[model samples]
Target: MIELVLPARRKDLGGFEVGRVLPAVLKRAVGPFVFFDHMGPADLPAGIPRTVDVRPHPHIGLATVTYLLDGEIVHRDSVGSEQPIRPGEVNWMTAGRGITHSERFEKARAQGDHVDGLQAWVALPEADEEAEPGFVHVDAAQLPAFGEPGVHGRLIAGSALGLTTPVPVASPLFYLHLELADGARFALPAEHADRAVFVARGEVEVDGQRVAAGHMAVLATGRATDLVAHGAVTVMALGGEPLGPRFLEWNFVSSRRERIEQAKADWRAGRMKLPDLDHDEFIPLPGDPPPPPNPMS
Candidate 1:
């Protein structure tokens, strides 16, 4: 029922902190999730600019989904999409062929807010790797919800425990967010070929394995795994059919390493278009130019 536990590597993204869990040296990806980052349980000081955080950057051959637990973010993309995502909502952006975007904390900059959430990159199938890039934003009310007694959850994408979200995904996958009251129990659905559980808050015991916050546990298949919450907890459970092997570097993911190299040159030569709304400042390729100033966050 349990395979291995991967702890998040804490990193300070200038102003706040980010916990990078996936693309691990131990496991590069779980199912279609090639990259995963726990973005700050850290506070953002008032007026924290977007440049201090993540500037406009490009991605290809993947979809980026950001689900926040607190605060809000303004997402601007090359597809002419400008949306603000609040806690409980999801912003799914597909960089099929190529796309660039920027995340700015507008409300937080004007009025301080907390930034806490999980962001994951889903690898596009080799067939759809060159499809047209797109973006979608689903409100919390649009996602499917389920619960009984102390267990309450929302299905972010794909199917889970008899419920499914309308969120459009390029592949078979299930991303769930569960909030369990202390003493409550949960059973991870075994509907997918690969499954993983991430403890975002509190603690839990899964089949005698104690999984604490800031850690992601890879679960074995074959049957549902039972877990009990020691306290009120937030659990993110996700998995799906694997997309075979993928090459990931910086912010690009592809099936062939040459594709990655080509993406590098494309970005270096300014072949990729910036977000229509955020075109002034972009994060240059590593070593291309000096970095931005670290503002208070």
Candidate 2:
């Protein structure tokens, strides 16, 4: 069995740490999944109050998938969506052409509240890259859930196990949230051209190789393998066939480099629209002026 282990790099945001796994030096992407971030398994530590806030930002030619293991977030988009997403639920926002949005920890959260989640960016097919933007939220109950003796799981998106999720996706793909009891094992489907398993917590072995928490194991293409949990464990299985080459710049994604540059210009010129409520605030463009000449040459 061929396996490529991707170590996560921690990025600090306010009071939390997000482990970035995809777009690594060795691997740029897994199928259409171009960006993957595992946020916070951190505690708030009493007497300190911090609210997760991601100001309004723009995106193009991709869909954002937000899945939470704990805590809640309110999502607002230019399409007039103001939805509160909770654990086990899904918030899928497609920036087909262009869209701006913001995510903030639910205002009702009390001090010392805990938060943790996973966020990913899936590039859209070239044909639908300029389709109208949209947003949808699916509750945990609306998704298919199944269990056998020692394994339980929910279809977070795409298709798996002869079942499909309600989350709208433009291309072929799969994302599953699974929990396994000690000694339990589950087999991978060969249908998806690409596949990987992320050990969210606890310990697991994929095709006989040990994978620790916070690490991802990319499986060999079209190979059938088994993942066995050494103890109670949580895993995220995600992948699909290739979406072809995509140009990713800042928060924009497109098949053409010019589209990304156009998006950047639009954002910097204050021409990009934003959510009705969060229209007043946004992250500014990062300046890239030429570096000053070296002084000690």
Best by TM-score: 1
lDDT of each: 0.89, 0.86
> What does candidate 1's lDDT look like per residue over 191-274, in tens digits?
899999999999999888899999999989878988899999999998999999999989999999999999999998889999
Candidate 2, residue 92: the lDDT equals 97
Give the range of the ten consecutive residues with the poorest summed lDDT in model 2. 288-297
Off by over 4 Å in 2: 45-52, 107-109, 288-297
lDDT of 1: 0.89
The all-Cα superposition gives candidate 1 an RMSD in Å to the true structure of 2.0
Clashes of 2: 0
